[model samples]
Target: MDRKHVLITGGVGGIGVELVRLFAQAAYRVSFTYRPGEESRQRAQALLDEVGEEGMHALELDVGDRQSHARLMDTLSLPLDIVIHNAGVGTKTVERAAATYKEQDEVFFRVNTLGPLWLSEDVIPGMLARGHGKILLMSSVDGGITHFPRFRAADGMSKAAVAFLGRQLAATYACTGIDVFTVCPGATDTPMFQASTLDALSAEQRRLLEASLPGGRLIAPREIADLCFYLCRDEARILRGAVIDASLGLGVCPAVMG
Candidate 1:
């Protein structure tokens, strides 16, 4: 098949990097974003080097800056076929939120929620004009975006809002053959998982935590990536506006496996 352009935000981090690897290998012309300085740049380039730089492009971007999307629209020489909205961070903002919920709201919102919104808004219009495109919003399997419990107040609220954003956007544009998928992958083994709040627990506690899962372990990063690749295909475009969960089995872990 002919290669198409695919853009992934946060494409330097653990799961993000893996997604880059997967998409590039699948023969998509890939463009990705990174924000931190040289170290991150080095790592991303190294990964691409291992793959020989064909059908891959990486650049630094602040996804929070919606205005930049305008620049991308103007400067991009190629049409984008797939976009994976993966720029976000959470699960350890407890202390930060406690101290500055108001101040930090924009930070989290921009990176986690608005980034995708702006990207989708900018990209989908062009998609409608072309009558073909696939977009996926990378979310968490921690909870359904709607009907979030009270315990995970902030993260839940933000994710829920973004989920609605994705849903509404998909509904608005689905008629034009522009597809959108809300992707929720479970706790995948990556740097984010390594840096998780659960890391504070003892090894036994970690094992106990694993025991709570039906798989008795965390989800694999590659698993999420492969699923992402699946969703972005033209064939999977029919699944638009669907909440596709890459979770092992949430809220129903069988005791024997756990």
Candidate 2:
């Protein structure tokens, strides 16, 4: 079988990085986007080196900008078979819940929600025409069944909406051979968690938080990537609209983490 074409957004985050590496190593035409950061560029270069020039490419992409998808298509110069919507934000502007939803910044909606919709919609037509495509969504467990403390209504609603959008898209494009899989990973050991406002919790509070999870440890990015790798393949074509949790069996360990 020929290698597939794949694109990943937020391609340098911990999970995104592993996705890039896994797909590139699999010999897929791997492309990822970063929003103007040296660390992102350097990491892209390193991934390219690891993949060794078979079909790895990196581009500057601001997912919030709908026009960037057009630019991405122009830059890639090929039909995409797999698209991973991995660019997102899990942060909340306010510390507590309010009576009504309020906007904090344009970025929260633009990057986390609308951007994926824009990209997926733009690519769906092409996938329909070709009768082959795979779209993966990187949502969070907090957006699914689990509850988060100090959660923003926008983030939760947006991700849940994204998942629903994927499900609807799958139903709409079922006969076209496109699979829409939503991945919900919990408390990954990424920069997002480290930089989370909850990091300010007292030592005992933090321990209690860790104790809530079954594994007693944060989920690794690679585990999520491995699942994504499987999902991106043609073999996983039946996993449409499915939400896979890669949270290290969280919410179920007896022991607590320090």
Candidate 3:
């Protein structure tokens, strides 16, 4: 049997890397996207090497760029059996007094919300033709299902739209063999999480934050990857359109952010 092909965006990122590795190990032909840059290029190459080259490929992509989305679709040789919209921008500390919110908010919406919309449009036709496909949209607790203060509102707004998008697609593709779902992860242990929320904190504050979490630690990228892998399986189609809270306990408790 031919291996199933999967395309994962932001493959150089913390969760993205784990997703790529898991899918590749499951005997899938993995095509993952990385932003075009020297650093991303090096990381992508390293991941490719680690996963072995035979069934793994890396493509340059800027999720926020429509032209990049077109270029990516044009470059694919395999019809995607699974597409994970994992690329996203992290929340920045909102500067309420500054006028920069509008500019920054545009970027959040473009990459986090619209990127998946555009790419799904391109891939869904192929999926429809084949009679089966899986799509996973990576969202977060904030704006995906719940909200926490001190973070940019745009970040949450963009992710909430992703949750809605997943449900809408699932409904549209119901019974057509296309399964769509959204995962809202909590404070995950990724560079983005560290930089956005933890890096500036003192040791005491960081410890307190960890203690507040359900597991007394950040959610591991591998945990999320495993969940995603299963969600794409044929059996998981029953969960179609579900907006899962992968947040442990943080989704219900905004106090954890303090």
Candidate 4:
């Protein structure tokens, strides 16, 4: 069989870098996107050099900008077998939602929700023509529900929409050889995770947070990456339309795992 091609958004970030590495190692022709900047370009190039995979490529993308997404779609030279909508942004103005919620919500929807929807529209036609494709949506445990403080409402709402989009797409294209999967990860050990408000937690609070999880630890990005890679294989067909909880036991709380 020919090596498959994958396109991943936000490939320079913690979880995303791991995803790219795993896909490249699996012999997939991988192309990823990062924001516009010399730093982003250099980091992407360095990653490609480190992976030593000729099939790896990178491009500048701002998911929040529709024109940028359009340009990317027009410039793509190959049919994609898999598209991972992994780019996201959560509102950082946590304690000041009253003043910032409106602006933050718009950005959250543009990047975390509407951007993926628009990109999927561009790619699904090609997938339909080929009769085979996969879409992986990166949601969050917060989207479904968890025992956390009521903050980052914009992020949670946008991700919930993403989860819904995945399910709807799966149902719409069921027999068309297109599959959709949504991965709602919990507190994975990613830079984003570490950079969150958790950093402000006291030592005792931090210990409590870690102990709260069944495993007494945060989920690793590589574990999520491995799950993603496995789902793309032929043997995992039954997982179509599945909303997988990669939350390291966080989903066990059914009452909270909405």
Best by TM-score: 3
Q: Could you tell me how far off, in angstroms, the CA of residue 230 lies in candidate 3 after the best superposition?
A: 0.7
For model 3, state the Cα shift of residue 200 in Å: 0.8
Angstrom error at residue 152, model 4: 1.5
Candidate closest to the true structure, highest lDDT: 3
* Residue 38's lDDT in candidate 1: 89
Per-model TM-score, in order, reads 0.87, 0.85, 0.95, 0.91
Worst 10 residues of 2 by lDDT: 92-101
Candidate 4 lDDT tens digits, 110-214: 888998999999999999999899999998887753435454767788888988998989999998989899998887877667667467788898788788776
> Given candidate 3, what's the lDDT at residue 173?
90
Name the lDDT value of residue 94 in candidate 2.
25
C-alpha lDDT of residue 4 in model 4: 91
Clash totals, every prediction: 0, 2, 0, 0
Which of 1 and 4 is the better model by lDDT?
Answer: 4
lDDT agreement of model 3 with the native: 0.89
**Tens digits of per-residue lDDT for model 1 on 30-116?**
888876578779987887887668767777776767766666666654688888888776755333333576655666677778888
Give the candidates in order of lDDT, highest first.
3, 4, 2, 1
> Which segments of model 4 are wrong by more than 4 Å?
93-99, 145-147, 202-204, 254-258
lDDT of 2 by residue, 1-258 (tens): 867889899887779889988887777888888765687689777767776766778888877777776787678746889999998766642222123345443466677778888898888888888888899988777665354646666676776767677777777877768889888887787777765634778878767776676776677889889998888777887677787766676523212322
Kindly indicate the candidate among 1 and 3 with the higher lDDT: 3
lDDT of 3 at 16: 99
